[model samples]
Target: MTSSPAAPGSRLASRLGFSDRVFIGRAARRVADQIEAGLDLVENGLAEDLRVADSVADAASRYLYEAGGKRIRPVLALLTAQLGEGNIPAVIDIAKALEMTHLGSLYHDDVMDGADRRRGVPAAHAVWGNSVAILTGDILFSRASQLMSRYGDRAIRLQADTFERLVMGQLHETVGAQPGDDPIEFYINVLADKTGSLIAAATQGGAIFSNAPAEYVEPLRLYGEKVGVAFQLLDDVIDLSAKPEETGKVPGTDLRAGVPTMPYLLLKTETDAASAALAVQIDEGVARIADGEDPAILDQPLAELRDHVVTQKTLELARTWTRDAIDALAPLPKGTVREALTRFAESLADRSS
Candidate 1:
């Protein structure tokens, strides 16, 4: 794994994070190289983890796993590990299992969202139908649990807790806000449970496995949750702005699928006449989009919404959450681990994709 910095754009370095700056000169080369190498092992180990006895089962389980992803969870786990022992074998194992959990979630998510594409390819459900796709997700989750079991109770308890949160997150989204529940608050809570919980586990698990100071664990967990919320909030913005080529998602994919996003959700809160008028347009537009109306028909509303105050508010909220994430790192000692994570959070906030 001693892939020293020979090329700036080497394959190993390219795999580290969404930002090109992640494994470059931002952190010490030795530490960056070590994490990059550990991630490579995680990637290979993931493929082996997905391997099954029946060829059909193998192909089904490996479909989404084979398709490329950002590997954000694994990268985060490895990055936090730099705080303590620096990507020990235990940390690598945690990274692998977390990634498996993430991949499995994507399979079911695509089925639910009716998403045709993921990671630049047809989603597993599109390729193999929903039943097989769901079963593949189950297989991946089962394997993830089996792998975590190897680490004994500490790991198993963490796995069980994370799994519960993830399910609750999805459940809340599906059932939506209850009476007396604030819509925005409910939405953010769903983001925390759905997206934030596993990310929190990744950072927390890194500290646990790498023998980092106990005090670092909670702060890192907080950082991970805020980062996850910020990531999804920005994704809400990108859903309206980014092209399919840029994000591997059609512009308005979430709206077209009847999924609620921040910009539209924020519009629902306005009481002023123009804002109220635009809110109706957005609701109607989303309904039309869900009914298979031509996307071009909604371009006017989309453009207006893109430049609207609510959209700007969504971006502002994302930045706020991102700042909170950085603030959570105050407990961490000032060093390479903190710097790398700080830059990592900054890059995610600013990413276009």
Candidate 2:
């Protein structure tokens, strides 16, 4: 399983960087170079995009950006943009918009989850309270829209669709499993909407804005969504496996929050009385922690759940999704971009094992 936490983007970045013994072709290196150069522009533009005339809005908008991130979505956009003119002005703008949207969501997530930290710093909500944190998210969404406005109707529509899916995912997650609903399937769908949709949009926007062939558009979108699923599934494994220092968050934060992970959900599928008892213990512990009791009470349950067979099942599912993501690339033409994409998908699976 995931024995240690890695830097946010380092797994895929290493693949793109050609860290393996197999020599990356010249074209692959060129695509990698283009992405590297584009990242600088994205970083600089992100700062400017988050700036505002109002001092509080400016600080709040820039808070997470300053804390730093893997910038995986934006970099994926830049990489796919190589299918056409690399780093076109429109591509840069789209990358910035997608990143802004992600940052905006994180602000809202911290508030909803009552998270204490993000990116190794205190969460915006923890520092500024819920109202300010929510407003900060709104400000970033507004800025993202402003950036998208530069691209006209099609871009605006795409942004709206992605935003809709993002909100709907959070809503479903908050409302939770309905009567007779398959919790496993329900959770997977939530992940697709929450994490996958925007990532798909990011890569699709890159291809569209860069004027890449129409055929590549759908394939990239599919690839992106699957990759996003794989990424989050690995995160489920990492949340239990990694130390706080490694992941930049406390182990079992989701458990303490009473949020059901894939592993927990899978365990719920078990019919054995022993499994049932463990699940009950975990549910009780999570409920206590959520009700403001000492989180230390969860230590035993969390440890037991982490080492369970269900956790291994979750890791295997993550690998299956990663394989499916690579399969989505079958339609793309043989080139460095396609190769890099395949490697990126594989790298995600490698994280879980």
Candidate 3:
């Protein structure tokens, strides 16, 4: 029932359209490859640090080194750098710092979410226990700060602000999950920190690395924020629509966790009766699941919710955000890089998982 990863090359061709695709086919890969190489440097940098630590560091290294994700932050950074005659090494350092912070957050997030798996493997907290996992996350965060500081005052300030935004975003989500939280407002606020901050940091950091003007930085920041929102919307959609094999995590996990995502928000707006019924089902299911009761009883209802309502609405919202993201890029000079970025935004809207 799970879907396969769309071929990267074919996906680029399809999304970029014929004329743009030809150019992006060459340029995007170059940028993406550079980003991957930069990420390798980051991994090596971390490994070097770990080598000097005690036995506890080995456990932390093992947890942090697991493979997952597309390194999109670093890719964005590299592409932004390529937009100008930027310092590539400095940009890579910043990108690596951002990724380390992100990965650290994920370690803590798994602990908070009580998630058993990440990318189809046991989560750090699940395998290493809460104490080691928490310490591991802290270590990564500390190292990220140390790394960013090496770039001097400006980079330190930028990274500090980014981390602040990240924390605020997570805090908003935690508070927004209470019984009476407005779903629409909740999702917007949550994503601004949880997803938007890092993306904004990625693009803005890129702009900084290039020493671009304020006008350029603002647009890139807006573009990144919009894209981040779109990406998270698609993620919410996938949680409902994708199978375990495709997503590498259980489907309906959001509902299972009582997380009110955009799809649930759209469902709330569609019909009062349906929303009320769905709410009851969710509440009951969450309680039962928490109590070690049968979750199978809720499966049919959740399926109906996904098929009959959430998917279409979520996709539409994602498309809207993607359009906004593209529009934010309007002021930037037209080039293969810009074109490829636009195409990438579109693909984010359409991706299956």
Q: Count the backbone clashes (under 3 Å) in each candidate.
A: 0, 0, 1
Q: What is the lDDT of candidate 3?
A: 0.72
lDDT of 2: 0.84
Candidate 1 lDDT over residue span 1-353, tens digit each? 11222334433455534344644464566667676787778877887878899987899887776666667788788878988897777888889889889988999888887877887688888889999899999998899898888888999998999999998999999999999999999999999999999999998898888999999999999999999999899989988884668676667767766788999889888888988887787678877866888766666777777778998899999999999999999989987678778878888777643
Question: How well does each candidate superpose onto the true structure, as a TM-score?
Answer: 0.93, 0.93, 0.86
Provide the lowest-lDDT 10-residue window in model 1. Answer: 1-10
Q: What shift in Å separates residue 133 of candidate 1 from its native position after superposition?
A: 0.6
Q: Model-by-model lDDT, in order?
A: 0.82, 0.84, 0.72
Candidate 2 C-alpha lDDT tens digits along 86-184: 799999999999999999999999999888888878999988889999999999999999999999998999899999999999999999999999999
Model 2 TM-score (2 dp): 0.93
**Model 2: how far is 195 from its true place, Å?**
0.4
Give one digit per residue, the lDDT tens place, for model 3 in 274-333.
777886777788788888877666677677777855677788888988899889998888
Top model number, lDDT: 2
Clash pairs of candidate 3? 169-193
User: Model 1 lDDT vs. the true structure?
Assistant: 0.82
